[model samples]
Target: MSSVTSSSVSLPQGFIPVMLTPFLESGEVDYDGLKALTDLYLEAGAAGLFANCLSSEMYELSAEERLKVTKTVVAHTAGRVPVVATGTFGGPVVEQAQFVKRIYDTGVQAVIVITGLLAEEDDSDEIFIRRTKELISLTEDIPLGFYECPVPYKRLISSEVLAELLPSNRIIYHKDTCLDIEEVVRRIQVAEGYRFGLYDAYMVNAVASLNAGAAGLSCIQGNIYPELIVWICENYNNVERQEEVKLLQKFFVDSMDIVHSAYPIIAKYCLQKRGFPISTYTRREVGELTGNLQERADQLLEDVDRIQTELGIASVFRKTLEVPLK
Candidate 1:
């Protein structure tokens, strides 16, 4: 493993948006569109950017494309916020470690290893521990994080595994999708005394998770209205905003299907409507968006506009590209 100072990098907190990989209408990776998207996230107050995640269509992207995209995002962000990119994708440990090294060389703060990639279905925690330990041993000095990726299968990490890993401080960030507030609290408690962060992907429990000491949010909602997520993070504890927070959380829960049912497709469409120069093309095999879905997405955007206006936060949506197309 390459040697680097992992301890010097603080794990990011706040709305670290799981970014979507923008594509041109012809289905090529839209490098220019991606630069705009990066700027859009930063302008909307994202504390960090999560590239090559599930939302970024990692399974569909070639390894070379993944590295290229990660490098583009890191160069554009220019150290304004930390970047975490997925480094493993269910392959041999050696191959996974080599990819980690390559991704770390992109100047990302940390490499996220999907927990599902460590072992097969029905594998015991002992196997998981053994494999993860070996991988860690091989990739020493490179900061690592865990993501409970839902694709292939969503393998929620057991407390035993967390207990074993957190103390070592090698795993500094966890993108948790367990969706249970109590479980999230338990995970946070397990990492208590360690320099780790748990970013909840379940938008419904974002505020509660933050209240329970979760590090921040890693959700698709951030792609559409990151400022709203940032607002909840900023004021989740304010006595005056209690009712307002509840209402916002309710909106997230109710609009889950409208905003995320189709995922990067709907997210890309939402971005296009917002004036981002990207197509709604997704690498997923999912077919084109139906008229009904398009109508629902439009309504969702309108609803979000109204909510932002009512909250006096419409100014956050202002889009000005800091990185011009080359």
Candidate 2:
């Protein structure tokens, strides 16, 4: 119940960025770059941070490194906003539960459970549910969330599962990657009236999902321009801004491929172009941003500037880009 514990479980509204881990050219974790990146997201109106998630290359990071990454984010944030992180890597329930406690000890409001890690592709829901229950029980009363991580495989949780788990109250957040608005609505319905929220990861139907009563967005689109995502969340229902809102929604849909080409590399490149102190060097073997993809990224940068100007939002990377929150 302390400020650093359960209280942080109530993640704020608007964009909650799935943070990218910054690395030096030699591939060491660049703590300084990570801090600067954190500043950029906050300045762009991020309501919270999803550190140590897939975007942070959690798979490549060792146990100590994962804790270090999560701890770095927690310490740098200084409680400005809530932070959540993926706790369950692929392993036995008890082993995953132990890391959950360690991640929780890093002062995260909630430790996220990756759905794919809980059971195999061929595993039955009953099996997944049983293992999930075991993981929850072993973690005691610490808060938990689920990420529909598309690694190993994209193992989704049905609304039935939500109903089964909601009574526990320990599950407070969900990063929904199902990509179907109807499915998103179903999950939201099940989560209503609890201290729970479903953050949509798909940007194509973001407007529909938000108006359908989703808590907010947690998506890759935010990695490119966090402020724009914040703007959409703040103005999604504003009658006068409907035109602007629709324009940006279309941008999210159209720009998805270009922005996602090389993943955090493309995103990092976009930031570097804006003069941020980040490198495009990524630990993941995502191909380089060259040829057609590189061309699109360049064009996308131009489009981003144009859209930001028309939308009347400033780029978080201002001239000097010294940190301040939206």
Candidate 3:
């Protein structure tokens, strides 16, 4: 490992927004659409922005496209808040290292390293861990966060090994998304102190994670509804927000149940419907949002409006947040 030291942690503690990539008609990237989405999230009270990850459909874009997207987002964000880009998978250690180095020069606040590209059953922890260590060494200058996702592409970092890697401040923030609640609780028991901050990646498990000592969330829903996310993080510990949190949780379940079925496809489609500009229908292979998926999205859109009114958030903005579905 290189003896490079990490810089002081400056990333916002909670409510990091995972941005959705807006595409063009011919499947080209919509840089203008990206700027509009960035402005929307910033205005919606996002503490930070996460780009080119799952939410941004990083895997679908070409290397050059990824760089351009990251550069455009950083420029659009205009330093209003922190921007964390994903530099986890690009094949071989050298390529991953080069990818990390390229974005590091773009001035992102940090990078979130995915364990491996393969689903959990396909890859061993040894390969993932070794790559993580290598990537960490290469990215010694810019701080990195470990993304702990679930099975079928899972890279759930064990608390024990995570502790071992903890000494290197290169790994500062972690997005806790292990589907196993018991595992998350157990890990939280091990991770303590202000130096290591954890953010919830799942909406349903977020409350428990918050109670279990997660600093806050880096939410996918924040891509569509940011004010609600801001309220939860700021009021996560407050007794008054408990009821509101429950309502938000219900909204999350209702929304995610629909959106996640098609994933980035449905996500981008919803954003486009809401008058939030997007260049394309969806990312590659993920396909366009339609059929039963379209119906489900419509139902959820209506529900979100009702829930927003119930939570007294509709009046928060002049133009109501719309996810107009057909």
Q: Candidate 2 — which residues are off by over 4 angstroms?
A: 1-8, 319-326
Superior candidate under TM-score, 1 versus 3: 1
lDDT of 2 at 120: 92
Candidate 2 lDDT for residue 156: 95
Model 1, position 264, has a per-residue lDDT of 74
Residue runs of model 3 more than 4 Å from their true location after superposition: 1-5, 117-127, 149-152, 314-326
lDDT of 3 by residue, 89-149 (tens): 6467777777787876676777777764522456766766666677777765767877754
What TM-score would candidate 3 get against the native? 0.87
After superposing all C-alphas onto the true structure, candidate 1 shows an RMSD in angstroms of 2.5
Tell me how far the alpha carbon of residue 200 in candidate 3 is from the true structure, in angstroms, after superposition.
Answer: 1.7
How does model 2 fare in lDDT? 0.86
Best first by lDDT, ranked: 2, 1, 3
Candidate number achieving the greatest TM-score relative to the actual structure? 2
TM-score of each: 0.95, 0.95, 0.87
Q: What are the clashing pairs of model 1?
A: none
Worst 10 residues of 1 by lDDT: 317-326
Clashes of each: 0, 0, 4
lDDT of each: 0.85, 0.86, 0.71
